[model samples]
Target: MTADLGARRASICPEPPFNALFNIRMPFIYPTSQLSLERKTPVVSTANVGQLAVDLIIASLSLQRVAILESGYCVPVVGAREDGQKGITTALELYGHPGVDFVVIQQRSPVLKVGAYSLVCLDARSALRLQSRKEEFIKALLNFIKDSKFGAVLFLSGVDLSNRTDSQMTTPTYQIRPENSPTLAGTALQRLSSLPIPKYTSPVSQEAQPAESSSSTPFIPGGGITRRILSSLPSEWSVPTASILQFVLEGDNRADAGLLASVVVKILGKEVPQWRQPGSWRDGLFGTPHDQTLFG
Candidate 1:
């Protein structure tokens, strides 16, 4: 069935756009003299051809990242605690059905949708492993850009605390953005800046004081593919926007992921009840630290 489908698609697919997009080259090989001469036509793999078509179809959808959450803590080899993934799951659960679905580019990555917004959870282990043969990955992403629409992409990941400078004080959340960005990207930055930090309220009195925030655009070391993918996407689509939140890698990364999700929710102008409180789970399997201190 797959072979038949491939053949039917081959008969109808146009050559120009696909050739240019996938960098497909056509070269025929020929052998020796008249008696021994053998002619061979260039062969294109059916799987590759099918994948391109699939990318085109999927990318054509109008999808936006009203809110996006990306995490790399739960990789295959690490088998370490998946703090980031768990955090995202918990946040989505708080908001009822988050449109749970999977869009398999290379591996079956999950996509959570809330109204017009989307939250994409990516695992860097498989993505980096597949980078060596990036034909499908790149083609799928490019097609997604060409077909769909994205308001802005928010990259969320944990960073190594040791990389912090003296000026920084504990688990600082840094925003990394390009010098010039698309409208959506710029909007993301604007919204984030405008969002009022959670304020402390006195029980007796009704006074509220805003929370403190730090500013820095430090390079995200050990960020895997999350940073690279978002940063390079704008160059491809022209109108796309992207931003990154590299939280300190120490302690409970699950809480870190939730913290990342909360920021996204706030920027979208949504209300989060008890947003500052740390997420608690009874498993105690990952051994995540209980400190949940978001600010210094």
Candidate 2:
């Protein structure tokens, strides 16, 4: 019965186009509402910390779903609705409050990592495809930001805690801005600079840094695509962009998400509202509770 159901579903769902990554098809953004996004700041989420922080922001600010982002770069996923919404949710979606100065792009699934899987399967072709997909995705996203006329863009990510230096141990959060970005004063990036958070310095030793020492391109270990996206921006680009990141180890990171979300709120100069955990977090986030009867 299960095999039959799986076959039926597979037949119903169309297969992704061949050479889709190589062809570089542009992602489609479908707006569900009449919300004007012009001049609004956008927060792009990456890594676990970023995703969870975005979730907290949506719940706290009561941000509504404004658009759905259809992209081939991400692994296709559909599951129960987030934030207690009625219908199912897809891999990527946009959320925002009407009058709020900032919006968020929540990525519910990780980027397609065919290369990692290819190692196990020993298929070199899959590795090449992964690289192409990632590059195309970055190009598509940057083009969208440039055309959207947004006031600024913020990226959130998590750095590997193991890479932290002794000095960095005092502060778990850090900020990175492209040196070439002509960010003016009073912008969200500048506002974040005013905070006590330390600027991210590459952990690589000076001897090893000579090869990748461009100040404009930062090294962010464990921050998936954060550095790539920032470095890919053209030097002549006018949009202001920055990344806020936290050093975290994989585990129950709910507390880390809260702290990072607070920093984001501060950067926007908005009063931090009472954070309400989404229904998904409260219910089965970690998994079903262990039965005490086992111990007995």
Tens digits of lDDT, candidate 2, 1-296: 87876666565543444544244444458888878888888999988899999998998898988988875678888878765677778888988878898899999877775421111112222122234556666777888888888889999999888888888878898888787576747675567767898888867454565634564666777888778788888878888888899999888989999999999988888886488888788664697778999999
Overall lDDT per candidate, in order of appearance: 0.33, 0.79
Root-mean-square deviation of Cα positions for candidate 2 versus the true structure, in angstroms: 7.9
Candidate 1 TM-score versus the reference: 0.41
Q: Candidate 2: which stretches are off by over 4 Å? A: 1-26, 114-131, 205-215, 294-296
**TM-score, cand. 2 vs. native:** 0.82
lDDT of 1 by residue, 68-184 (tens): 211121121222212343212211100111231211121112222111112222322111111222333334443443443433434444445555555445434555444334554
Ten-residue region with minimum lDDT total, candidate 1 = 36-45
Clashing pairs in 1: 83-254
**Worst-scoring 10-residue span by lDDT in model 2:** 116-125
Provide backbone clash counts, one per model.
1, 0
